[model samples]
Target: MIDPEELGRALRATLAGFKVPRNIEIVDDLPRDDNGKIAKHRIRAHYADAGARTA
Candidate 1:
């Protein structure tokens, strides 16, 4: 299995600081659109809902 922390560490080592992401979320699957493309909007909304719940 892939380790998110290790992946983050590797990214930090190889990428410019500003280019690295601040958060990482591993999921079983990504939401897809009718055309089978990744549904980024749904992903954003899902995370937004999660953040709101926590706050």
Candidate 2:
């Protein structure tokens, strides 16, 4: 469980007045590329609005 509130507090104090990010998605690990680089495209897909789901 990621604490957005506490995270915001630390970030706010660090930056000192920059608006905190509203949607903070905390993940265990980020997608990486073959060369050991961050796969930004995969990250975007993961967060994409897949719309509402129903059981």
Candidate 3:
């Protein structure tokens, strides 16, 4: 399995310091829309619910 931190490290090495993501979520598959496109809004909504539902 790939370590997200190691991958983040590699990314940090290649990208500008400001471009690194603060948190890297390792989901089995990213949510997609009916048309099979990446759903950015869906991802955000899922993350947004992480704490709310837990709380």
Candidate 4:
């Protein structure tokens, strides 16, 4: 498994260099249905409604 702290630093570094509104969203585990397909709608809602929910 990826180290959460290391991943956070790397992600922050990468996002910091980005210039597209600087809106970065990261999630540990995506919401999925019983079949395991990602629930894009839920992810979108979460991202859209509350900015980025960081670790």
Candidate 5:
């Protein structure tokens, strides 16, 4: 399995600090809309509290 921390380290090494994500979540599937597009609102709402805590 890919290690999220290791991936984060690699990204930090190669990308600008502002371009790196503050959080990493691994899921089986993302919530999708009826049209099969990613449900961005749902994702944001779901992770809202987590983001708040981190911030």
Candidate 6:
């Protein structure tokens, strides 16, 4: 299984060009719809709320 923590750490380590967002949440599995499609909007909302809370 892919370790989310390790994945996040690696991403943060190698992400040199882009400005990584402050609240980088490493979810085990991304939110999905009934059809198994990834719910990007929900993920965006989740991070938005998380950013708000941290702010």
Best by lDDT, which number?
1
Question: What lDDT does candidate 1 reach at residue 27?
Answer: 82
True-structure lDDT of candidate 4: 0.68
TM-score (C-alpha, index-matched) for candidate 6: 0.54
lDDT of 3 by residue, 1-55 (tens): 7799998999999999899998776778888899999999988887789969988
Model 5, residue 30: what's the lDDT?
95
Number of the top-ranking candidate, with TM-score as the measure: 1
- Give the TM-scores of the predictions, in the order they appear: 0.78, 0.60, 0.67, 0.43, 0.74, 0.54
Q: Write the per-residue lDDT of candidate 2 for residues 1-55, one digit (tens) a residue.
A: 8698888878888775647676676779888999999999987775564432321
Candidate 5 lDDT over 1-55, as tens digits, reads 7778998999999999999999776688999999999999999898897779989
Compose the digit string of candidate 6's lDDT tens values, residues 1-55: 6666676678788886365554355557888999999999998897799889989
Sort the candidates on lDDT, descending order: 1, 5, 3, 6, 2, 4
Cα deviation of 19, candidate 2, in Å = 3.2
* 2 against 4, candidate with superior lDDT: 2
Cα lDDT tens digits for candidate 1, 14-53? 9999999898878889999999999999989988999999
Tell me the number of clashing residue pairs for each predicted model.
0, 0, 0, 0, 0, 0
Error of 5 at 53 (Å): 7.4
C-alpha lDDT of candidate 5 relative to the true structure: 0.90
Q: If ranked by TM-score, best first, what sequence of candidates would result?
A: 1, 5, 3, 2, 6, 4
**Counting only residues 3 or more apart in sequence or on different chains, how many pairs clash (N, Cα, C under 3 Å) in candidate 4?**
0
For lDDT, candidate 2 versus 3, the one ahead is 3
